[model samples]
Target: MKKLSNTVLATACCYSSLVAAQTTNLNEILVTASRTAQSVDETLASVTLITRKDIERSQAITVADILQKTPGVMITNRGGIGKSSSIFLRGTSSKNSLIVIDGIRVGSATLGQVSVEELNLSQIERIEIVRGPRSSLYGSDAAGGVIQIFTRRGAGRLTPSFTISAGSDGTSLAEVGLQGGDQNRWFNVTASGITTDGFDAKTTGNIDDDGYHNQGLHLRLGQRFDGGHELEGFFSITDSESEYDDFSSDRSDTLTKVMGASGTFAVSDMWLVNVSAGRSWNKTKAFSGSAFKSRHETVRDSFTIQNDLLISDDNQLIFGLDYINDQIDTNNAYVVTDRNNWAGFAQYQLTLGKSDLQFSARVDDNEQFGSYTTGGIAWGIPLNNNLKLVTSYGTAFKAPSFNDLYYPSDAYGGGNADLVPEESDTFELSLRGKYQDVNWQASLYQTTFKDMIAWAPSPTVLYPYRWLPSNINSARIRGLELSADYQWQQWLLSGNLSFLDPEVRSGANKGNRLARRADRILNLNLDRNFGALTLGATLHAEGRRYTSDSNTSSLEGFGTVDLRATYQLAPAWQVRAKLSNLLDKQYQTISGYNQAGSTALFTLAYQPQ
Candidate 1:
């Protein structure tokens, strides 16, 4: 079955490639790749930019839903909307990627993964995704890449908006927001709520329906002074409750909060300074029937200061310092509960003739693991009038999480404080071109990993039969990515394809495919606009993947199609409808987990004219 699907996809790609070969140009501005605003074509790394208009046109309800269609990205969920989810980038593990919310790192210290499922798309204005190693500019946990989300910002005159939606399975949504700003001052506030009586999450065992509820709030305020100084404050929070089927518990509640303040000053004509501080908090509680099971909480406090200097018309330099403190509180006993880390980094950019070069280095000092250094260099060459070639080499690392070193010895397993961080080196080459009405990019990359951490039986004589976390494996990952877009008059088409080979290089599981990472993925979208009405369709597909490192179980490949349409009812009102999983295909990304089937939603929105 998978082979047949692959053949069909290949044929489609060939047809689309011929149609998209004609020439086109796209000029998008992004910031996550270099920490500075620049044109997408000028950056040395592969990137994707999602704007507010794109979000609205897609009618996506969550961040994960929007990212699932992006190149070099794959998302896996255990169940419906508010369930546990994981994202893999370029064949790297979820923890290898960094998640930044308004320039602040947000994740759990113990699990070492971000809860992107809880993030509200209604409060986000833009998202920038950089697909490559980035530990040189950032401190750690960037072996895969970086994803930065920007909250809603006010612009121009005052505007107020609201949206109401109702759909299948007792699903409903409501959102309201107000944004306004002048030349010197700006503010934005938004609140939203979602509820759904979803399908069962498990295949067998429990047949009862599960339900989820979520609420989110976002606020932002900023002011610019006359002396080239600016100040800003922002806050975001999400509260959710979900019910699922488990041996001990069937319910859980989670609360996530993030807040920060920042200031920017222009000290001189050639120098600029920026400083910021922020905090992220996550709390979860589990229950078994009517009795309490357990509770866990993680909090992170972070600070950053940076300086940018213009040395010459074609040369620029940037330096920064970062500090982070992580604390964990839980009902289970552990060896340690807190830690701190600090780092300093510098970057240089230079341009000469038709070539651009970038270099960056960083040094990190952790309270538990002394010091480590990482760096990278990249070069971009203009091959012709409309074609360019870019290559880069970089080193990245992932720090050991608290659960890897501090978990108490028990029947399940014990943490090993002697465990070291995982490190990797990557080399990449890419070609980008633009021809009349089409734009395209292709990239090839390879990564070698060392000191990879895993949980297995202890080798020491002291605990021979017990399972413990250790550095027991190594891996080599290679992949190819191709993406293209073509626009003509009122019609636009875009698509992406990725092929990955993620394998354990040396271990008992050597030569085996990594768990939950698919070898092939494809995405396609087409949209057309006529007068005040628009229509769009999307197709997403992935190949079979293993469910465990041993490759004992697997899930079959599947594809899904979605349709959307929007019509303007008045100057200040609009209506939208979406039909997901139109074929009602039955498939699962995980061995025992259940995925949502056919669903539909309709929304009405109002805006002041």
Candidate 2:
């Protein structure tokens, strides 16, 4: 199908043939990039789990609106849905993506990258996407994949909840929550707030915010002893203020503050341990001219440990280790710099016979780009009883940020500390099937990148470090992903299709077409359940994209439709309504930026006995 110009985003395609009609109790299905508690067909990669009743039956409020309806994911919004979003998996880039919450690492290492529009899913409770190249278990932006988000904890009994919402332009939202605990101990707490007034700024907009304000707070705690041994603790805080219109001429403002903490332990029966730390403090103020002002700060810390040994009954062994540290401070409307980093890692997983295999490798050494190594392999097969086959290969590396290495602006564009670190090699293949109520999946992918950094010109400066950043030996990308889900008895239907082909296989912008990527994307979802009433509808299609970097104007191709309804007036109470985009479909997948035509939301809930 020869067509690639970016477009390989993963996160969609789930339903392991309902693992043969789930007998339930898969350890209650909860995973944070594999800490343990297997079963999602016993994981070997390609994972997607979204719950909270699939985020309130797809009322999706952020995290790029539930990753644009999951499935071999692809999202390109430059406006609305929490504004500015970018992600691409199989096809990579978005600064080689990697995001985590709960397990920390909420992106942005000095705007190095990671923006799903600053996450907000009303304190997410579930979301796990790990498609490929996990940087051998997470090390360099996971080399193009990894999206974990697990909030809400505590289950059964004790409860408290609250919600508020308002629609259209001046949008508004509020939330409050509390969970329960009993056998052992558990806790879940949440607080949220949002405000928006944006829209109408045309001229290939990038945001002159008609308005913006955000707030967040969360906590989760758990403990258990008396044999099973376990402990957990987590915390989060976020704040934001926004208004800016990326390209040239006029208004500005951006402010952010973030905080995080994490802890996890399980000392017996196949050891497991985790530790996390985070901090993000950002400030970008500009009121008039002098081509955009600047101010920055960043701090990060990480640690991880793992195990799952059992060498018989069809082999089982998994091992792990990790560490990360980063610190940055900047002020470069002129000059000011301080950068720091350190990394360490290891991984492996194996299980044979019925099929299950995995291997991860990692290495990160950077005092300023030096030392690199990353590895991957995955295989899962069981081609009978309903078909199944999977394959994977990987390698990843990235380094070059801090405004791409020091910033100085004339309307955003500066940084080049002799940039380096940007490498990749990825491959994938898949096929899955299930009869009975229909369920299917298909996948194919390819990625190749070498020293593919960005920004360049320096041959001895002249009007912008002569514009320099370097590294672009070659580039290549390919993709295909298809998904299907069908269920009876209560009706459930799903669909997803994506295709991309990226290029720039050499120098001088080799073959062009790779900025703000998009080759083709599609999504469809429908759900219905007569009795307690649950109805849903969704459709999003995008294709046609290009935003300079030498791809030329062009950002058309559009389609949007959404409608939702939920009712469960008893046993805890619930009532929900939503209408987004409806027939208002205006377009722009990225190129100047313009999207978000219609919107609406409503909700009510209660539970107590």
Give per-residue CA lDDT, model 1, range 259-366, as digits (tens): 988877767656667788999999999998889987889999999998767676567677999999999999988688998999999988778777988899999998
lDDT digits (tens) for residues 538-590 of candidate 2 = 88887786664566566777888899998889877888889988999777765
Please give the CA lDDT of all the candidate structures. Answer: 0.84, 0.66
Which portions of model 1 miss their true places by more than 4 Å?
Answer: 1-26, 409-414, 455-468
TM-score, per-candidate, Cα-based = 0.93, 0.31
Clashes of each: 8, 14
The window of 10 residues in a row where model 1 has the poorest summed lDDT is 14-23
Residue 251's lDDT in candidate 2: 41
